[model samples]
Target: MTTISRFTGARFLPMVPALRRAADRVPERARLPVAVGLLCEAVLLLWWLAFYPGLMSFDTVTYVWQVTTGHWRSDHSVAYDVLVWLSLQITGGLAALTFLQTVALAASLGYVCHGLRALGVRGRWAAAAPLAVVLVPSTGTFGIFVWKDSAYAIAAVLAFGACAHLAARQRPLLHWWLLAAAMTGLSVFRNNSYPAVAVAGLVLLAAMPRRWRRIAAATLVPTALALALNFGVYPAIGVQKPSTSSYYAFNYADISVAYHRAPQTFRRSDLAVMSQVAPLAHWSAGGSNCSWVDPLMAPPFDRPAAERLNGKLLDTWGHVLAKRPDLMLSAHLCRGRIAWALPRNDSDIFIQPPVVPADRFGYSRPGGLMDHSRFLPALRTDPPSDGLHSAGVWAYTAARTPELTWFLWTGSLWCWATYLIVLRMMRRRPLRSALALAATTAGLQVAVLVATPAGLFRYMAAPVLLGFLALPLLTAAHPADRLPGADPARRGRARAAARPQSAPPRSGAAA
Candidate 1:
């Protein structure tokens, strides 16, 4: 073969012209503006890695250990761990692992930039937004954290974009299938991330044309398989018993007890006390009167002592609700307040005396591991709290010449508001998209608080991921419009709009 033909056969040939076109399309004068953005990203990334690598949060260490040991059976989704394992094998040390982490983070940030560019943002501007996202001092700041959140967020964005592309009829079957696999992988990453995958599946379903029965078929088959793997088949095959902590058990116990006692109202305090004790009773040695579910709710509940107290409290709550009218309203409202104001920490952590005691029984058990875990120590020791310490801003403000905490809070609230506004706008034509996104965020937050052993502000990262993706699109001027430029190559393909609107003719067919 001629040298020219051999060169044409190389992989780079396909992408070479595209690169040239990008250069041609971007005005020569735009280089400085683009360079400024790239330089800013470099500076911010360096600052984060140097000072607060991984932000050293509580869950990070467990993940680090998991990666180092190549032990992943305990983890739900092992993608990040798998990546770390591969990177470590290649690099062979902690320093290499750290560098690998930054590289992975940069790649994920680049993917976010790609999403932005597809939405009409210039490449440089798109790139800078993810940096701004990283600099926002919220969930994105944890980008370097070894936990699955960063990886899950990246997977989610990729899945969302792929599903969106399929919806737009831009990508092929192979791409959608790959995206589906990633979504499934993400579902197992962290307990909270499962809902995002479920929502992504819904997006895929919505994107497909109704005539294609296979779309619904495709969506349901994977989810069904996942269910079988998680609940039905996994256990039967000895994979692992589904870990059901007492947290969810308690919620169910509370609802069930309330249901039985509902006809005879109760004072809110009465209900609260009853709700707290029922789970304890269920787990009590002699307290068979409480349901099995109560035990589940009180996984850490002390046997006889917890059950005996819970039974009495349940009866007391039922009696009080039966008797007091005004107290009922007070009790119902109080329950709502408690639910809303509930701490984002594992109740088990609070169970320990000396608050942040050296020995607290966490999910892994004997529970002292709880206190030893990364975030738990900070939660116990980090004082002045958000309100008292003004979120630790005295030093930050001195350095930055601004109240970073205050600014972060204000900016977050504004971004949150913008997210809601976008949801409202999308609700008209794409209500399912808006609702699915909203539900994924809100439902997971509610579920996480009720189910998980740990609850931290960082737990809210999944929702924030969606909010950032939707933000630029929300802020942008155009709606339902294609990006500004057409591929000059595709200009020839742009034919009569008057053509029949069913599916386009198969490739190579004459009009």
Candidate 2:
């Protein structure tokens, strides 16, 4: 064969010219990270442009209010608002915030794609990493959307990569530190994320290699940082004071359900305690809406009086629970259903309208990106990213198609997937690291179930993202496949391990 033909065959001949030129720009040492990063970034960029700037919900508008007014509140995530505040300060647009999260989404998926190769996903599976990250709407359409859930969900992806790498027996120097950073993000991004992070941390610590225990021990830096941030920094900044009314959703729902089920048997004093928060009629109105608490808590609900009389409210809630555990159980299932099952309410499952609602809060000043947000007008079908918008909408529709819904939208499905991965990993050595992921994932699921105020998919975003990314593991080639003959060039030197090592390694290695 001519030298040119041989060179052409060896180098980039069969690859598409555009991608070949793009790949040539990346250095060999950084190729995997850069390639996967760019691929994921490209998908997110299209989503952002298609939705131009990104998707938002009512909560996002509220976040904008906090960022615009600088009156930080803890009801949502103050840390996340701080990030948006910083991005707006630096780039003068909320789109910059969108870009920043897109980058994070890229890094997270990139890291997972890279680490999965070390955990045995190889050959075609390895080649499919970039596509895998884009396949799930959680990974594809998530970053461009504005929500604190996106931040914590990205953190969970980072943590999953760390756990996978640690379990690979090829833990990089950055593994534990990456885990630490993810934990800190988890602790700060959501109020309920603290206990979940703690649960995951303990599981990781227990599952980590004994020799690496000290190193893994340092990963708990987030614990102290989380405590300080929650207790110290937040208090010093006067972020948001604790309130007994935080539990009002669940407790009030229980009381409402009890009243609806059997109001005649209920004591008058207990009913009076409930009345201090809202009228008996209001309770009945909201009792039927187990999916949302707005009707019971809105307007005339008298939050101050509820706070003042919280002790009595709890006592009443307890009395109802003891008298009618089944009613409370039914209420718990309805309210926290998203965490453990496919949400029955169609509206609750992945509602990302491509437009940010009009900012009603005067906090959103005119003449800024927030104003541009107001003027989004409509997505032009002829615009460049409008194709992506169409494609994403198509994918979103596909995601709801029976089987895909379980994989893409269901939280418990991913939680179960996580346990299966844990079981697979547990069969390997350095046993402690196996449970790290399960802990983070299932722990979050439990936390959401216990404290959930409504049946929203964002509350369980972490599992959906992490679960889909790890799917290749079910048919993984075994980390050993990446060694020797796996690379035609490396096959020459690897012959000494002998036995002709084969042209390419297959999924011969064990779990």
Our model 1 lands, by Cα RMSD against the true structure, at: 13.3
Candidate of highest TM-score: 2
Given candidate 1, what's the lDDT at residue 32? 33
Worst 10 residues of 2 by lDDT: 374-383
lDDT of 1 by residue, 32-107 (tens): 3344445544644553444332233334445444555434443344445555566546644223344444454455
TM-scores, all models, native as reference: 0.53, 0.81
Candidate achieving the largest lDDT: 2
